[model samples]
Target: MNVDLNIIVFGSTGLMGTAFETVCRKRSISYVGMSHQDIEITSMEMVNNVIERYNPDTIINCVAVPSIDPCEKDPELPLALHCTAVLHLAKECAKRDILFVQPSTHAVFDGLKEEPYTEDDQVKATNIYSATKLLSERFVATYCKKYYIPRFPTLYGLRQNNSMGFVDKVITWIREGRDMKIADDKMDSPTYSIDAAEVVISLIVNNEPYGLYHVANNGCVSYYDFVIRIKELMNADNNIYRAKDSDFSSEIYKPLRTALQSVKLKPIRSYEDALLDYVNTDVIGVSD
Candidate 1:
């Protein structure tokens, strides 16, 4: 736990990856982070070469084809990125005796549970994206002896790209002065990216136990409620908000609630606290 470590992060440009980089830099951790421009993770050759070059004690994989709609439209990319590439990376990491860590999602569940999910709960994926991720988790469990899969809920941060996170969508509506429709029935825990980054960093530094764990912010809230809180933080007019949900959409097949129950790492802030910091710090106007 005391040694200076070399850590390699994949998907360095994505939300979680960016947070991980910022956290590592701020903590003065020796790390090498790579975006897609640096190397394509799907290529085994590239992954192997990078792993050999860096010789990281720990490898955190933040890469994924995160487009749910696109995954539903075409499952090929999800399979390749989430399943195939991750399996290959796990094999390589195992061969090299490196600790592998993957951020799984609450979407791995079918969303039918009445309460929050735990690490040992049965997973019944209801969509292509979750199915692929679940398959990746299975591969990791089978092939790698030293790995941790911490399943998390929706992650958002001001540093997150506008294209991702529902929080960003709300920020965009407020900035554009447009009316926003939020789902009142859809419920899940919203974990701040910084909070998630801290937990992952702690795991890396401590060589934590190898298993699945649930980690997210303190409480759960519906999309409509989450947006209302954001509006209050941004001081946006609440009169512009409308509530809507699964009763209105065909594509959303999951349950009304799927909040995660973290047994290992508790979030540092409530969703609102982290979100307020985000709104105060990020200067860029949200764009569609």
Candidate 2:
């Protein structure tokens, strides 16, 4: 992309948005980021107003209903945020001839495949969240002339409010002297937000093809093994226990193994290395 290109980022408060902002600042890329408080994405007037104000060359949308249960509880929100709002944004970007970059999830697959999911595989959304995301992807592809949809897997990284990821949740439990049980059967390629951000930037800067792409770290692991690795890395007390998906009951559907691999872009660093970097830089000297 052009060095003078202006990028507008929505959902600026979330993990992915935060990572995008951090990378933009470090690379001296011109961007304007807006959180929910700054703009109501469901409102077309607000969306249009922000786009008119920024007049950006690209719009990176990181907005979505992050969790599955909430989406199931209130389907209307996902329809608005994930589907309608996305269509509106794509239409605007199409009208303005701006590149629309959408960050998607690996949950689009049912995860029955033994190997990692590739971009060419047909999507099998098993839950409301995945359904809405798949719909959004379709809208972007259909409406926008120039678009890049990068599907990512379980992501964890430092946030604006110092929030923790699943691994960090384990650490928190250990610190609180609480017992925890994690699922061993559920598998995914947990991605670091910063690394994902870098890939997105590279995709835009390099002017890659306009289509769906799977963006994730090198390998995959089960939630149980991930937590065990975290405990070993931190050398925390032994309060963690193994469990399975059947151990917990939920109204929402979650894929058993949705680890993703990108055939287009080069593989990013491993989750273990990314987690270690995060722990050392963000967790070591910091106190809750």
Candidate 3:
């Protein structure tokens, strides 16, 4: 599993980005990690410079605003980061014949479908985040002839920042014996970032056909259900209750069901298996 493949990864400090770095380091893959400061994505001049400098064989652009509420409230920055920056990167990848790997979200679908979503399914963006991301996919498909758009489900990993994801919070809260109210109605495939990192690397290393793909754990689970499993694993005595998304009122609208299923590639391990690894190994303490 070793060869010559120059890779450049943007968003090197994010949850998914860090996973990629870890995987590359572990596998001894040749990669140059770049954070927001290393290269300002909004500017095309900077992008061109970096591309020329690294001259990577593949460019994995994980640069994205992974939040629904902010996108809903103000769409400007998300549009720039998600859509405009994407177009720039795709254009560069097309010109240079660099394989573009973009980790998109499962939110592209409206979430009305009962079954897990596949690539052929119709996409309906219900929020600004989805809309911009969907547009980014179009840009990549249209511009970059060689590209991989792996639509990701709810991804979780060790966060370097003070803020933590839902999974992290649940782990901490349960350990502290804090009362919790999780959403039973809403369902999402909570995916592990490390697994996603492997999928992305495999696509490039194995030279898979360039196109849209779904990279998620086998099935989706409700917050209540997920927390229950965590509670059981930890064996903590804390109140964890089932509630609906409607219970807590907010302007942001996330789709009810977004469990991604792949038609092209075999589905990764189940959420339960991945979760077990995260709970047992990662165990990053006290997420803010």
> Candidate 1 regions off by >4 Å?
1-3, 160-162, 238-242, 283-288
Tell me the tens digit of each residue's lDDT in model 3 across 31-124.
8988887889899999899999988999999888877888877889899999999998998899999999987999999989988899999999
Clash count, candidate 2 = 0
Residue pairs of candidate 1 with colliding backbone atoms:
none
Model 3 Cα shift for residue 239 (angstroms): 0.6
lDDT of 3: 0.87
Instruction: List lDDT for all candidates, in order.
Output: 0.80, 0.87, 0.87
**Residue-level lDDT tens digits of model 2 in 1-288:** 336668999998889989999989888899899998899999999999998988999999999888788898999999999999999999999999999999899989998998889998889889899999999999999999899999989888867745555655776786676778899999999888899999998888888888888988889999988888777766677777889987899857788989999887788899889888877776665643
Off by over 4 Å in 2: 161-165
TM-scores of the candidates are 0.92, 0.95, 0.95
| Residue 41 error, candidate 3, Å | 1.0
Worst 10 residues of 2 by lDDT: 159-168
Models sorted by lDDT, best on top:
3, 2, 1
